[model samples]
Target: MIEWLLLLLPVAAASGWLAGKRSAETVNADSHSQLNSAYFAGLNHLLNEQPDKAIDTLLNALKVDSDTVEPYLALGNLFRRRGEVDRAIRVHQNLIERPYLSSSQRGQALLELGLDYMRAGMLDRAESSFLEVLKRRSHIGITLRQLLDLYQQEKNWHQAIAMAQKLHEESGEATESMIAHFYCELAEQHWAQKKAVETTRFIKQALASDWRCVRATLLQSSLAMEKGDYKRAIRCLRQVERQDPDYLPEILKPLSECYQYLEGQDKFFFWLTEASKRHPGCTSLVLARAAYLQQRGEQKEARYFLIEQLRVYPSVEALQQLLALGVPEDIEAASEPWSLIEEVASRLLKAKLNYVCGFCGFGGKYCYWQCPGCKRWGTVKPLAVGT
Candidate 1:
């Protein structure tokens, strides 16, 4: 009832103003009296909590004209904003049906109706209305943007790509990154369906759309590794450092696996050293190098390396690794305190967020090519594990 009253107040004011202005402009005293009577009747219905009748009475009283059309459109938009999508749809639909409306006015009404449909989750109706508005060449940019968002929501990547390109052409906004992510999405879908050829093709298209697309490179690397093409996988994984060094941690395990398959641990060790130097304070890279040294029976060297890294960039992970490696030789007697500290360290590490969305500040334990919070592609990045 209160919601209806809030909606009716504006309509009542607009109707009263229209009645006064039209009465002063013309000597149509009888017409003014009828308008006032209908307005009062709608107000009475609203006060009596009969909102549906009030809406119908108010709408019927406002004859569609240049003066009344704007007020009607405003009322519909207000309904949508207030989450009264059904009412908004009725108002806009009524305006669209009026033959007295100009082309631009009809287009505006149709656009508002489409928004109402979208808000109500009637996506098909929304899409049809937006497309019709596009054909009418009315509100081109906004309609294109709406179409793009609609296709994305439907997971229609092909249509999304097309709409994104059109939006870029219309608005001069750079959409290469967004287009590349859409292509990557298609690649992932095809890969899931075992369509390897289509997957590769879409991945190539993703890279073509945005050469700096780290997700595409990672997908290409995964595909190559699946076929036992370790050298190609190695090349692709190594390319990530150049594309976006923040994702260096992502490539480490894969790159290490590829090198292990090829029996090229020496080459892997050399690259890891260079990468760690280039991207210092990277706990994963530092840890990877330390693990590699420990595997090579260079525990002393690994311990010394971690000590140096911790001196420059303090990290809880590095301290934990150092503790693990520095367990006393007299394990029987010194074990109790060491076990207690290890448990605490393990708990702290598990509680830490491994990845975070740079765009929305959403933290998580796993990596996401698309941020779950903002739904943006390639915004989630591994957190640097150093203070």
Candidate 2:
């Protein structure tokens, strides 16, 4: 806000000069005299704490010129920061209508106006303003970025893909991951509408854009599973562990379903045994192994396995699995362990989120290719093993 005052000082001085100039009768003789008198009167108003009149005296004297637009831009930005959207819009619009503005100056006004529209949730207008900015290509990178975000907000994934590609080309920024997410979004839209062919096509496009996209891999696996192609579904899901181990928990149930459908329980046991070794202390792996042991008529082995796991790395999921088996008989220890562990686990279970943003620490129960809090692509990853 102080910055606004600083900017207004210069604009106010120019306004004062204009006010005095307009009030003068004799241009040659009394112009200079009238200016000095007005300047003193404005200062007297200021010294007397008549700020409102001083401001009025200053603004009523304002001249719209090239030199003045920069400070006005600052003023407009201040209005935006204050949530005065209409005022900010009017300021930028006024600057844009001035015939004296240079091309670059006009672009600056348009960019500011676009931001005003964005802040006010008028996305269509903001999109138009940014697209107009892109026409000159002076600020292509920022324009493309804003357009991309706008498209995403509007769920216009096709437009988002085009804008992201344009941003990549213009700014030399890597946008493969973001492009993949856009394609995945399209896949999800198609899948939700029960358009399997379109969904498969979009999922394939996502993989082509970024093979490392686990969401696309998951969608591909889902599509294959729907077709009763267990082998293909298993292949797609197995790729997830290699592509990014962080998402291994997400594939656990899907992998189990594929193996179950194929009656490959023995193969699953071997795979889980190997996976437990590779990703040791992984919550999902430990929990899966416990259930697997229980299913194999080894309830005692499952109980002991969970006990050892708790000693190595205590977790809420493991505790829940333990309670399902029954509370242990520990009468005299450093503390009564069973209830203590259960209490801690309950708190953690309530507090912990399933997915968290790596960039901004935003957490949610569901996965998002783009972070809901930061609006950043590929930042919201699954919660790692123990979180």
Candidate 3:
């Protein structure tokens, strides 16, 4: 209420100033006196906590003229800031209706109205208003951004791509990663619909947009695996580790699976060794190496490796790897909460990690190309320490 009063008082002063200006010009002194009375009445209504009455009084008190546009704009924005979208819409809509408004002034009004619509979740209306502003070429950067955000929210990747391209050309900001993510979105949609050909095409487009896209490589690898092309899958997985070693943890399991399908644990071990050496003290790579040792009846080596790695970089996964070595093979897999300890431990590991947004530290079990918190593209990736 105090905030509104603060805003209302300035508008009251502006109304009086306009009245004084009119009186100075010797034009309709009687009307000027009347407007002054109405303006004071509006202020009184506002002070009495009748906001609707105050707004109505103010709107009626101010004659729509060249000098009144700024006050109306300010009031409209104040209403918007207060989350009164309907009132903001009305104020801006009223401003736009004034036939004497300058072209740029009308554009400003339209932009405010569009923002009100967006705040109200009237996306279609907001989009139309933004497009209209785009035609006027005023506020081009902000209008393009609004259009892009609208398209992204609607999942209209095609339109988003075009708008992003325009925005990049105009603003000189880096949007390649976002364009790649949009292509990836299209790829995933196609893949979900079982259109492998279209999926591959879109994945290629994603890589072309940004070749460092790990998601694209991961998707391409999955498609290759589906076709029994293990070698191609391995190649793609290797590219993922190279492109973003932060996601090596994600690729490791799939990479191991691809190697297993090819009946080449030897090759998988070699890749894991290379990755571990390249990314030293990486817990996932160390554990993968330990698992390989255990499978090959090198239990002593696996235990020693786990102990050394755990001593350096402790993780729930690494600890589980160590404890599993102590669990005898005869224990029933379906035992009590105590028997479920390993399962609990593993679940905790997966739970603590999933995907995290680089921009805002938002972690979740699922990947959102657009971070739910910061809404940045390609910022969400597999959660790792220091990432």
| lDDT of each residue in 238-258, candidate 1, tens digit only | 999899988888899999999
Q: lDDT per residue, candidate 3, 200-284, as tens digits?
A: 9999999998999988999999999999999999999999866888878788888889888889989999988887877887777
lDDT of 1: 0.88
- CA lDDT of each candidate? 0.88, 0.81, 0.85
Model 2 bad stretches (over 4 Å): 1-11, 14-61, 328-337, 384-387
* Worst 10-residue lDDT window, candidate 2: 54-63
The CA root-mean-square deviation of candidate 1, after full C-alpha superposition on the true structure, stands at 2.2
Worst 10 residues of 3 by lDDT: 326-335
**If both were scored by TM-score, which would come out higher, candidate 1 or candidate 3?**
1
C-alpha TM-scores of all predictions:
0.93, 0.85, 0.89
Clashes of each: 0, 0, 0
Once fitted onto the true fold, the runs of candidate 1 whose alpha carbons sit more than 4 angstroms away are 326-344, 385-387
Candidate 2 residue lDDT tens string, 1-387: 344345446655665455455546435446456546655665666667664455445433344566566767876787789887887888788788878788888888999999999999999899889988888666777788888888988999999999998888888999999999999999999899999999999998988999899999999999999999999999999999898888889998989999999999889878988988888888998999899898898877999999899899888788788767765454443456766876777788888898999999999999878888999888887774753
Pairs that collide, model 2: none
The order of the candidates by lDDT, greatest first, is 1, 3, 2
